[model samples]
Target: MLSTKVAADTTPSTRNYDDNVAVDTKKKVDRARGNITQRRCLIDNIWNAHVVDYAHVYEADGKKDGLISKLERSWNVKSGTLNSNTRRNIFRLSAKLHRLFDEEKWLLLPETKIVDQYYEHYREAGYADEFPVIKDLSFNYTLVAHPDMRQVAIHRRVEGVDINTPGAFKTFIYPFDTFPVIVSHVHPCFVICNSGQKLKDYDKIVAFRKGDTDQRKKRIARIQSFSKRLDGW
Candidate 1:
């Protein structure tokens, strides 16, 4: 059961991307023409994903006419003619738009929220009831301060999170290649969640498709060649 207190509501919440290097540094390494998805309008044009694994397809709206109307109106799906997709488009563009309106405040951004439940075995100690094992958390994301200080917000329904109790659970939320992923606990040797949990001391995950089995198989040639070179040395 969720409740919204209309009287104390002071903020408009929406999705905000959390790429914080101050600009878009991530690039598509092997972009294809046919599989690509490009969304265009008057004010913005964005190239979404033809293929993605660690990342997702991006979106935007470059239409200039909506700017004036956006500041004054709460434009979203279910208004009338505008579809749900357009409402979503506005949310993505909000980062750049809000930056312009606020004169660039980095802290105004909100990151995705995630919750986790971690349990320890009490059976060894002969206990029947479970102890504290759930964590509730939300991280606020801010761009490093360029390209209009990108802002994004997302909330995930964690199993057992009570806003009333602070610091009962551990949470992590960070921007991974511009997309925000929230996860709990860092596993060094274990596989990280494919959903985008960048653990501390983590390395980048390459996007690949098993459907392109031949492409991946071809990479083995490079590895074999390198081994031959080592043998020659």
Candidate 2:
């Protein structure tokens, strides 16, 4: 009888949750997993995300004329401030993505296997994509408090070093202290990806596309042009 009772207890039955709120919460959590939002520019196809924000979502006034009002939606991704950990996550994701691409290229897997192999290799290598898979993964970090300015991911690794912990497998890496060093660099990108990170300092960033001296001159010229236009109006 005990044996029979144990067997019955061990048998599993399909059970479902009835609470709608609980279900919805779980779903929402699932959705916001990895959505780290930051404005960035592609430097050498590697993204440089400056966590500092300088953007304002613009709005238009009512009673605009037809021609001017006809202008479609306009927006801008302004630069903003950032903190250290957030910068770490952002650069880490980017570097991992690039690293995966490199590994994939080296693997030369048949096209048929690319899809299956892509993610597997990504896990084995690292997740630098920074794309949040669900709500649970959402860290909700913002600029100004995070990375504050000059953090970056560097992937240049040492020569002849074999990675066993997925260590410097790709360029963008940090303490990821969990993985073994041998596993870090993987195989193809096994150069023990070296990274040098400097925090974002306004003077250091050179974020402005125009060089320093040139930028000042350009700004003066632009103001002059705008002033003349306003005067004509």
Candidate 3:
């Protein structure tokens, strides 16, 4: 009789209000597990737009825009303002996507070659300023903030030789700190990929492209729909 009573109380129909909310939340969480798809969509939006712009510039005057120059043009950021972290993420993501999608050589120095050759040169130099500032190696280095460099060096295992042989550079470079390496070199005159039109339809992301008033309204409505539930949460 006790076991029967326990089973009856534990049934979904007889579960308490908190249990119902918990079950509902769990179901929603489970269904919301497409974060990777969402992130890919986000990155693809930026990438496809850039590729389209690249193709347009190329077709207009036979001029291929450097990736960073294109970004600076679009974003209105000053040159050399991009930190090492942002540059690193862009390089890694672009390289990964290129591998996955078989993107043609947009960069003058291929991503693998840049990582292997130019990036290794600065990293092994054992100093922040030792990172190159050349045009072809733009992807390899950036101005790292002193605080960030110090924080990274904290966990790094320092050697007596590393400390004794250098200036303040040793205070920054340590054995374990990767310090945000870069990927590909974007040459000034490199050829642009001509797949911008194809990339527009590649991921069906064009449906969510910027400047669609109706789609934007629908997205806002979806957000507001859940935002109303925040009070309950």
Candidate 4:
């Protein structure tokens, strides 16, 4: 469905506290705690409600456009902000991920592959104040459904050209959030899929829980394993 043979194979995919003393100390604290609890519930309600809606849409129509629209709406992402073709490409990507989900072909991308080491280098060079620190940058996953080189070799034998060659395939990395309820944790993760169909798609590039710490470690391990084999190490 991705038009590109290789892409057809790959792609898919806080708290606080305080204490104090005062006149209405107990009452105020309780009220404040109540407000905080209510806010948390409200936030979860909004997010989970959309998750349910996404599942419903995917089930009812089995279409990615509907799901993508819901995701965009939840984030206040205006479809108008992107050109028609860019939007279409995103829709296609969402569709491809869903298909990969069905096929159980989602590949976990390792952070080492995309980690911006230079980001830290720059920060250490007295640029820390110049940029916002995004601690979650390392938590993002860049899942891809890429075929192995061996598979590509076979493909080359048949197609007479190696799709894996540089520039032969166009990779699209999307900062996709909310992958329905199936992907437990619902944390933000990147999705890398190629649609060799288009090379000019300007739609520029681009989760978990368990307190998010343990989840991240597990993902990193899995991705590292995949990366090893991918690199033929």
Best by lDDT: 3
lDDT (Cα, 0-100) at 129 in candidate 2: 33
Kindly list the per-residue Cα lDDT of model 1 for residues 110-184, writing each as its tens digit: 121111111112223222134222222222222222222224332222335664466333432222123232221
* TM value for model 1: 0.16
lDDT, candidate 4, at 184: 18
What's the true lDDT of residue 83 in model 4? 15
Q: CA lDDT of 13 in candidate 1?
A: 32
Candidate 2 C-alpha lDDT tens digits along 63-100: 22221122211101111211111111222224333332
TM-score each candidate: 0.16, 0.16, 0.17, 0.21
lDDT of 3 by residue, 1-233 (tens): 00011011222123232221233322332233222222121112222322211111111111212433443333344654422112112121222333322222111112334233333543364222333333443333211121212233321123233434443132334222233332232221121122231123323223222232453334323322222322222
lDDT of 1: 0.22
The C-alpha lDDT values of all candidates are: 0.22, 0.22, 0.26, 0.25
Off by over 4 Å in 4: 1-62, 80-102, 109-233
Candidates 1 and 3: which is better by lDDT? 3
Question: How far off is residue 36 in model 1, in Å?
Answer: 28
2 or 4, greater by TM-score: 4
TM-score order, best first, reads 4, 3, 1, 2
Shift in Å, residue 8, candidate 3 = 67
